[model samples]
Target: MSTSSEHTFTSPFRNFSREEWKRLNGQLSHSIREEDLDQLHALNEPLTMQEIEEVYIPLAHLLELHISKFQELHASSNEFFKRNHQKLPFIIGIAGSVAVGKSTTARVLKKVLALLPSKPKVELVTTDGFLYPNKELIKRDILNRKGFPESYDTKKILRFLADIKSGKSQVTVPLYSHLEYDVLPNEKLVISQPDVLIVEGINVLQVNSRKNGVFVSDFFDYSIYVDADEKNIVSWYINRFESLRATAFQNSASYFHKYANLTTEESLAMAINIWNEINKPNLHQNILPTRYRADLILKKSAQHFVKRIKVRKI
Candidate 1:
């Protein structure tokens, strides 16, 4: 028998094959250029216009439908209360294993959703900014557990989400640098009442016990979990590490610059070790457990193309 991780299309989700999903694209055309896509995707992940047409077009339409409904409901609530409050930004949370392309998904969605007829102001932020600084992690001795749930400042994250949800203006979020592998000092992203906000991170869907019973996923209007086999994810992680070694790691300022001069075999071994010791266990223990919690799951093939979509049934 297949396990839950196998995603055999059990209850609560309506599963669609790639062909079925693509048929829902329904003549929608986007103006995204090839050069624009190059800047959107992550290293080692290739996103083509064809994939955008087949997968993201329909997905964007679906989100617009949800957004429209949300607007209607908000107006109705205001009518009932005889009060007109500012509309809160719709928050979307995207979660998946590292190197599984969740960032690419979030970026593409942000672009597509913003280009819709409504032309709503859309913004994207990653929860990496919420992680404790490397210094604090080292002080706490959880630097090795960087991506784990405990490494994040949950209280601060909750406050940020709460502020945004309350329709606060000019909320500031910390900035993190992938090149330096740390939260940048004194730099922040200021959000000012955007129409939509996309929060992407592996830990977005995580639900550890809290005193006030608030969780990060609680603020999400919609959530997506990028899904793939553990073996495929492991392969992708290794390949990404190898690619980084040749590129980003060679930079003197890169945190992993020490691995830049390693031989091919040595680099491969190091990638395997990091995946086995760090990313793999975190996937199984923290990330994978939250998969089903997502409202939608974008299941991908070994080639990194989305092959199937499972959307929660209303």
Candidate 2:
């Protein structure tokens, strides 16, 4: 991969500058609108049409090619077996640190993929739902390590992926509420047949040992990692937390409602403490180690804009 500051010939990834990657878009055009941007972007993260056209549109095109190849392979396998069967949804996993804007990428990619020529039905699900509820986390005494790999229900996540890949007609996933900071009891996300399923979360790319050695990433057709410097990500996290304190946290029902009343100095101190105590350690120990496991990596600038992309060699 060649970036402005680095070049390597034997790396597993081929790096592309933003301009080079944008050229891959060719004649492709997106259907994203202004209002769509409002709904797609994460709080305190800036996503411009330029970013979509240059970064995500090209990414969507690449995924479309991958999806086509995936379908062809499935059909070939079916013919080889002398059997006819429905093709499972192509699952794409997006992973990154807490404030790296992976959610925006997943949401934007889903919108773009759906608007493709085939108009395939694309569904987005975050692994947050698979996280143990707050009560369960407290019971396990890992509430402070919420985003760590151990905080997730590995067994349930593996089962969910297995069911989707098996072409199940109906499968349900638990629903997680960010405002409440918990997995809602009895609420679920019903996933029917989708042409594409995007699973986004910080833990998606982690290597895990399950029964028979099946990993959560085993079911993914493609995976992406959003990357940035630790200092930049820490800044972004603090910024998002401060923004939430002014908005969502102001609500009485918000899990972090108490933070809304904090003075600027107090909020800054608290955000830093949370990052140092929880997020920073998790990033270094778990998330950063999985970056190489992704098929593609979006390396972002300090401003949270993806400046370069690294694609794993075929």
Clashing pairs in 1: none
Relative to the unseen true structure, what is the C-alpha lDDT of residue 152 in candidate 2, on a scale of 0 to 100? 91
Which tens-of-lDDT digit does each residue in 5-112 have in candidate 1?
Answer: 798645999999999999998545458988999888988888999999899989998999998888888889889999988898889999999999999999999999
Measured on C-alpha atoms, candidate 2 has an lDDT of 0.91
For every model shown, the clashing-pair count is 0, 1
Cα error, candidate 1, residue 27 (Å): 4.1
Residue 108 CA error for candidate 2 (Å)? 0.4
Query: After superposition on all CA atoms, how large is the RMSD of candidate 1?
Result: 3.5
